[model samples]
Target: MSTKALDAQPKFAQIKQYIIDNIRAGTWHENQRVPSENELAEQFNVSRMTARRALSELTDTGILTRSQGLGTFVASFKSQSSLLEIKNIADEVRLRNGHYSCTVLSLESMAAVAPIAIALGVEVDSQVYRSVLIHNENDTPLQVEERFVNPTLAGDYLQQDFADFTPHEYLSHVAPLTEARHTVEAIMPSNEVCQWLGLFNEEPCLQVIRRTWSAEGIVSFARLISPGSKYRLGGHLTFKKKQP
Candidate 1:
């Protein structure tokens, strides 16, 4: 957005950006302590609630982790990415002994773009449902999910509360997957992704795009992004000696 747009932005949002800028600037490295709610309120001359909202939003997006006794600290990404063939991110967090939470940014219908159309086997410009979600582990932002659904396959998608359940969990319960294709790459996050993930523009993100099919046909297409500084793809395998 333009400078005027940012200037006109809300104070909490400005605080959010300020926190991200410091993180990116190495002023607040991983595991470092961030200003307390009272301190931030004083520094920004805003109410404690305003400061808390800024910090809460950042924590929800996985930039900071809060403890019951300890003050908030820059979250460290020490856990591995999903190892299951069909990775449910919530499950991943649980397996790592972390509390899981989600914030649903959007769930709406729009005309499909070309790539999304092909992924859903719908014609370009066909109506499709899309949702943007942020998943956090222990109040730290973990992943940003951008999902496009075939409306015919998931007609009630918009009616569901994703914050109570994940798009992956809901779809898997509604339409069991028959096939899936995944693509993974590391790249600089987009402007919006950077904002949502609480990362600087130069921060790298692990991008995982996937398309799924149910017995009835295409079910959904999704893009999942993880902060590269804190996430990695991981799996385990067993080896056998042949007639040793």
Candidate 2:
């Protein structure tokens, strides 16, 4: 096999790009084992850690798979998810060639409760907006989104038609993103959430809670419940050096 000459880029980044390019070029077929870390280090004249970093990054990016005793192999590019990136459910379903639809359950203005106040970094009883929507894909219920918006930041949210547009698309254009926190868990859906999602009483669901901040402060908080059968979560992870 012909190997490309390494450039002056960072060791890990160069390694990652090399693997990606090779995979894209079909030099390394899916599920096919690549060179060993020591062999790669020798070829690149870099340390083992650098080679490991490259392989780890590819593994995290779903380009490679590391088996316990079978060694590292190229990963299959099937149903790969952009979990690391914040995605709109409607858009994701469309990408999968599935029909997508949503029903708005509630959209109103209210006062932030204690937990909400703490989440939004606002005073108790501050004005907030709440919305609940159930999303379906190909006629199968998928996700139920229960969202709270800090009206002080996200203005006139209740007036918008969410059925035509997603909150993520709207807020991304309106608010400058600053930070985000995501919490994921598996649980049984509540009676109301289950009814909205068309899930049986014993069916399990995936709960995802996301809080987003803008330049003004916490702008939105959403609790999403997804039917386990219809939804699966996937993402990539990377490690970076600390800045001084």
* Winning model by TM-score: 1
Clashing pairs in 1: 61-141, 62-140, 62-141
lDDT of 2 by residue, 70-159 (tens): 889987654243547788878776654457888888999888899988887888998888999887777777788899988877787999
Per-residue lDDT, model 1, residue 21, is: 70
| Model 2 CA deviation exceeding 4 Å by range | 1-82, 238-244
Instruction: Give all candidates' CA lDDT scores.
Output: 0.85, 0.80
Off by over 4 Å in 1: 1-77, 239-244
Candidate 1 per-residue C-alpha lDDT over 113-226 given as tens digits, one digit per residue, 9 for 90 to 100: 998899899999999999999999888888999999998888899999987889988899889999998889998888988888888657888999999999999999999998
Clash counts for the predictions, in order: 3, 0
Judge candidate 2 at residue 34 and give its lDDT.
89
Candidate 2, position 40, lDDT: 88
